[model samples]
Target: MTAAPPSATDVLIVGAGIAGASLAAALAPWRRVMLIEAEDVPGYHATGRSAAFWHETYGGARVQPLSMASFDTLACPAPEFSERGFLFPRTALTIGHRSEAGAVDGFTAQFQARGVEVVRMGAADVAAKIPGVRAEWSEAAFEAACSDIDVGALHAAYLRAAKRAGAHVATGTPLQSARRMGDGWDVQVGGQAIRAALIVNAAGAWADRVAAACGVAPVGIQPYRRTVIQLRLGVPVPAQLPLVIHIGGEFYFKGESEGRVWLSPHDETAVDPHDAAPEEIDVAVAIDRLQTVVDWPIAAVERKWAGLRSFAPDRIPVFGADRHESGFIWCAGQGGVGIQTAPAIAALLSAQLGATLPGGAIGAVDPMPFAPSRFA
Candidate 1:
């Protein structure tokens, strides 16, 4: 006969991306938590394919709190992750053609009213930023605070801190099934059965499927595919070049390092949940738009890839416990704002569940917008 299986844990996280990793780190001090990832290494999905920016004004109004809440974490980070002055001096600028002037003005006014760091820039200013950008293309524009985020360092810091606090981080353990057990949940993963008092659905692009598997109602989370391409710029490029975004959101480009630049079309087509790949048409579109912005010859194609940014119908993240499912919590629908808001999100939900957490910072972020029961 075989010995009894391991006992249940206090919490089980279903994804090992920024959200799940940060939560495990925040909650490990006082409870037993197990973070499960299907991949051989963590962040093998959306987190790995991010364009690596820390643009604050990118997400919608409801998502503002999370970015604001993440300020301290990104600014004065711990030694496990050192600030590389990575953000640089890039201002996030949105430009519009004549047809998009109204939308551009609306966007500027809306964010300006919210006290977001945004101000209108004339077409000449836009020309200075993107030298070859068509002047007629700038009917309206605005600049705001933005930075390029170091995705690797951010993810590693979360995992390190979480592990240090005794949380178990297991990769390659795909969750097979989950069911409510006596006062908790019995989760089967990688042919092993384990029990947990609470389950966190931080599965990113696979979040909806995770919900269906665990007998929770799906909240109609949609994953959108976005592609990015890296180019080597042999010519000297200014370090302060603001990230240029089309007011119509047709394309975006920003400096990566001394002689490298990254470009994307800002495309958001709905896609199936899977390992996303770059489509030829998407790459063509991005290159066409990028040529409009800069005259620099693409010396060499460094790399290209794509990732899924999962969003709820309202395009804001879902947090808190399910209204019907007693112990099911949600940390999904982070969309493109995952890395920027990881710190605040962890604190917010950890406090919502009354789990022990770091910094006592949860109260700083109002939990109303991110409640998981919003769909119900």
Candidate 2:
């Protein structure tokens, strides 16, 4: 006797990272949702390896509203959803050398025009804020709204809330193929078949690949690798140290617990999607850059890792329905601000899926800039 066909779900979300998980939670109250991940655990890629921080200007003006919209949720999550708070106050300082003083002014003016508060600081103030700062760094811009995010807890909260809302989450289930079945889609996952009325491509670095597998036109999403390293310092790092960055975008470092400092070379090497690993030369370059910024002594290299940050040609996140195929949605190209912008992005995506925007926070924000059809 033949077996019964697999049941259909209202929505099938691919990629169980923070993007997929948060979207599932947003849609669960309105539809039957199913989230699938290729790896054994959710958030095994970019979300897991993120140096999670919420900076309004991190993705530039186009992406700032999304990050700002997500502030309330990240700063104070729902009591039922999360007991552990997700965000903590941490200032951000962007410094420039004497030769690049104009760059610092440009950075301040650009964001200030968008109504973002920024304070100009002289070289002496920058040095006082960051111990042992180089003398050549003469100008700086300070953003007091920046904060550190507890990424792991936030990801878990979204996943848990999604499950509680009746969304089915499947990990270690790789999507083999997908084809249009009537008005819905028939997808093969690992060996089982399933159907869904809508497909959300939230696969992060592998977004373009996932779209192609489903016969949807790719949006030119490119994945870039970023490396980060943790160093054990000989001297104690101030617990109140702000996230120090270079205005020229060379490197950034901040203090962590236990006399350790986290540093990144701000590298953006183009690469294909896979489990990324740090290069030895990149690590060396990070230390060398850190030396120029400060006179701190590095005792030892504690840990190092690399993660893929996907971006569109324009660097703005691609969200909304596909122009050619409305059933295929684009939730890719979040860049480095994916986690920081997840709450607002998910809300906007939910609205696109026929749900009314609660509180209308995202409704007031323009969606034209992030529409996927812009690429088409």
Candidate 3:
């Protein structure tokens, strides 16, 4: 599954998921870039499986900036980068049981303090928005600015932009090993060997594994499985149903076209890096939890899938050049917010790689907190 890989490059990015693809697009104008993917196609794993949304509060405060910074681009990208915007108007609601009112209040206040447009919803407001929810599930907050991301278009645009900027992508080429030489690293992918001045670890769930393959110290990147299932509901649903979330992080569901809904248990089971699949127990739990919140009958589960959400030890994004190994960059550990934060993170990394720091919130984002030096 190896494409004809280059013999040498200024930069070699392992794992051609959103992280690598976005960064490749950002840096390609200034550097010779090549991206290698283990799968026959790019974004076949986590990136492809993501039910992503550009919600500001989804990743908590520390990650909010990247999501916020990337909004303008995701909402409206340059004409050369994308044919259209990737964000669609789909707001979010963080609901809690009556007993969890304080939790909902705190959640709303936290984001409201950050200048997010949010409204504290009363019981009636909650019931009106999500028709079948239980009376006990009254405490809620609404984020009008939350939007659903067009992940496919966003990712494909980055890949196209990168290729247009002279970046080479070799699909089905996995990094087998790498060794640091005098001025460059010798990387072996399958039977092909290439020399690169710098190697970017954007391998998603395989981030730590890639670092080990290069004899670089691992940053404790761990993968967790999140399951999402599609259901054919027994009741008529609103066409513009907002994304309903549990403030305590137990479950989330949103309406789809027709009588369908996408639901998740919000379970994060720590697992090894591999192709993830939905567990039946998790699916059952999801249905049970949703039942507790709403009377909507689930006629049948039409489809189910799972994906990995990788995170570093601190549960924050890891970016910038490695602390001890500047030639190696860590662009993994974005957890679930990687898609929303890609534009900012990619720009930050490009800045570290010699590109000018971009203006706006991306420039205000301090890369130090996300730097790999914390792990060192």
Candidate 4:
């Protein structure tokens, strides 16, 4: 059964997605934390809909550090967190056409310079891996560190840790509004007003809306929809087929269970925050693009879905206290890399909330680049 909202708390975390849940877990041990979710269940929107992968090069240079810093937590967590890791090994191969050789070269060189293991592949090597021979698509960069993330397990672990640490999780409760009252906040949710010392806008797609309700200035957090489809191909799905990605960002597909493949067109259509559903046109375009990449005929479209990826105007995640607001904080704008970077982001935010940050890669990485002050 779900718990009722608290009358007051030291910290109020809005949205119970990966962002909110992880932060709650990090802060609950030392603070009176409460997480309120608008939906009946948490993570109903973006976090639940992700076709997530833990590829260090997926989110560019700014996000790579967070992803890299978070790997240990996900792959070899403390026994108290989870007995087993939530990541499975799967290699990633980023390919480009003959004409885009320069782009492929630059892409491989860029990540390689960052110390990511990237091997330049020739036509024969690419053919040996993919089994499809398209003369045009030859040049490729192979990354061995890419792995499939068990997103559900990770989100659940955070929520469990938060609950175990005595954080209140109220379901079907949404933040109606908030006002600065002295050094704290007077917040309304689920028909009652609550007092909170700090309010965190970890609302994902509705981040800007949450800010508006809190009487803080909106930071232009935009939501974009990304589509994915499960395709049953005529050819047998290779047991060890790596994740195949287009260097130009056209599409990516990886093998799934029961001889099916999961594919995405890398679409980022901007829209208002809401319950996102995949459009037929987006699914069709993905199929068309996939056909151009591999000769495997599609037997059927087994499943399809869409999710929202929210981002700040600068495309970097926003964390830390708001510029002018006294007790309002921003933990939004994670885009699509939220799951992979959850632990690092959580650690950074918890430290700002007064918890001691443990030393390691997370402590070493600078957080100024992702601070909310940059937006101000």
Candidate 5:
């Protein structure tokens, strides 16, 4: 026998990736949160396609604080659901040629000020860090604190914790409609009507569409495509080679375990909401950049794919409910920092729902910076 579906919930979340699941787990303790995923399985998009690197100094200005706020949860993952260490040993090295020397110096100083172990390394030092690199091609570089994230394990940890907290997670559930109903909103998904006191838009690339569907102002969320290629290196590089990035941000590569390497051209091409495919031109660019710095032979590309990273106009995540609307919350526009900053964003949303903190969990940050009103 099927249990009768409730007409309402305290919170209705769209998308079951890191953002939605983490938000659900945080609010389930105080609210009846129902999470919906369009796919049969969760994390079908960017969350699944991530390169899985976790560098505290990598996010932009607005994202840095949130990333720092989430360190506690990720570093010390909940024992029951997530036991694997949050990160593996891998440093970050931003490499630069003569033309990019100034930018390299600026980056080094900025990271050093943030308590990161950042220091300018010459060609020889860079070679010491990563063997087989062409010294003449590399003008300057800096190695700092960075690591690889356990993307799958961390996402699952949040999902399990959310489920155990009594939150409802519905995969293969597509939200068909949303409308205002008295003090809350009514949403229909999977042929079942659910009333939710608050509707959190955590739908990643589809966030703007979801907002427009619910009569909330659109936040101009643009999804950009980023491609990554994996290859097996013939030469044995450092066991913990830092993620080497082109100083101008044109390309980057990370040494994976067991002599595997991941390369990206840092392509930020704008794209629509859909499963993105890696373009040949972009992959070729990555290959060319990788060849320029290292004297390594190009082996076959073992795998390649692309993901949609949604960013707001200002590239900051929108975290609060619409000021005019009583129950429509915005938890989208995470961009590429979604996985690393999930905890703080979830706590911010929960605070808004519980009315415990002012300006939500993002505390002290100007809400207008990420508010949908800016688009209006």
Candidate 6:
């Protein structure tokens, strides 16, 4: 006798990273949800390797509102979600030299116009806040609202909440095939076959591939590699040190525990989706750029890693159901803002899937900018 077919779920979400897990949490209350991950663990990619900071203006003007909408949840998480808390105070300073003062002015004006709390800081102010700040860094834009994020806690909270809400999670179960079956879909994962009324593509760098495998047209989602390193500095890094970023986008660094500093070259090299590793030149470039910004000595390189930040053709996130295939939804191309915007993005996605927005926190913020139809 043939084996019975796998049960059908109301929604089948691919990619068990923050996006997929959070979406599952949001939808499980209303629908039967199943979240499948390609790896043995969720967030084994970008979400796991994030630098973990919540900055309102990091993802440009189009993406700011999503970040703004997520602040409340991060700042005051639900009691059931996390008792350890997810966010802590960590200011951010974007600095530029006298020659690039115009750039700094434009950066400040751009975000300030969008209602983001930002202030212009003189070289003296910048120096006082950041020890050993170079003299050439004469102008800066200070965002006091920036904060460090406990990524592990946040990701775990979402997964736990999702499970509590009755969402089934399957790790190490990569999608093998997907095809239209009546108004729903027949999807094969590993050795099991399941059916779902809808599918959410939150596969990060493999978003396009997942779409194509399902016979859905690709949305031009491309993955790019970014490298980050941790250093043990000769000078003690203050516990309260603000995240320092260069206006020119060359590098950024902030202090971690035990005098260790986390540094990134701010590099965006185009690459295919896979396990990313740091390049020696990228690490060297990060050190060189850090030296130009501060006079602090780097005692030793402690750790280094890289992760893929995928993007749509236009760089803004891709959401909404596909134009051609209504049952297929696009929730990929989040870039670096995925973690900061996860709560809002999931809420918006839930609304699109016929659920009410939780507490109406995303009030009046238009979701058209992130609609996948824009690409069509």
**C-alpha RMSD of each candidate structure in angstroms:** 3.0, 2.5, 0.9, 1.1, 2.8, 2.3
Considering summed lDDT, which 10 consecutive residues are worst modelled in model 2? 1-10
lDDT of 1 at 332: 90
Query: Which is the winner by TM-score between candidate 4 and candidate 6?
Result: 4
For model 1, the run of ten residues with the poorest summed lDDT: 80-89
Give the Å shift of residue 254 in candidate 1. 0.5
lDDT of 1 at 302: 88
Ranking by lDDT: 3, 4, 6, 2, 1, 5
Compose the digit string of candidate 6's lDDT tens values, residues 1-376: 1233347898999999999998998888888898889898899989999997999999889999999999988999878777766889999999898899999999999999988899999989988998888898889999999999989889999999998998888888888889998999999986788889999999999999999999999999999999999999888778678988888889889888867889999999999899999999999999999998889898999999999999999999998899899999999999999999999999999888977876655756788889888975
Model 2, residue 199: what's the lDDT? 92
Leading candidate by lDDT: 3
Mark the regions of model 3 whose C-alpha exceeds 4 Å error after superposition: none
Q: List the residue pairs that clash in candidate 6.
A: none
lDDT of 5 by residue, 235-300 (tens): 776557788877777888888766778999989999889989999999888899888888888667
TM-score of each prediction: 0.92, 0.97, 0.98, 0.98, 0.92, 0.97
Off by over 4 Å in 5: 1-5, 137-143, 355-376
Per-candidate count of clashing residue pairs (backbone under 3 Å): 1, 0, 0, 0, 4, 0
RMSD of 2: 2.5
Q: For candidate 5, which ten residues in a row score worst on lDDT?
A: 358-367
lDDT (tens digit, per residue) of candidate 1 on 204-243: 9899899888988888889999999988875766655678
lDDT of 4 by residue, 235-263 (tens): 88785688898999899999887468899
Q: Which stretches of candidate 6 lie over 4 Å from their true place?
A: 1-6
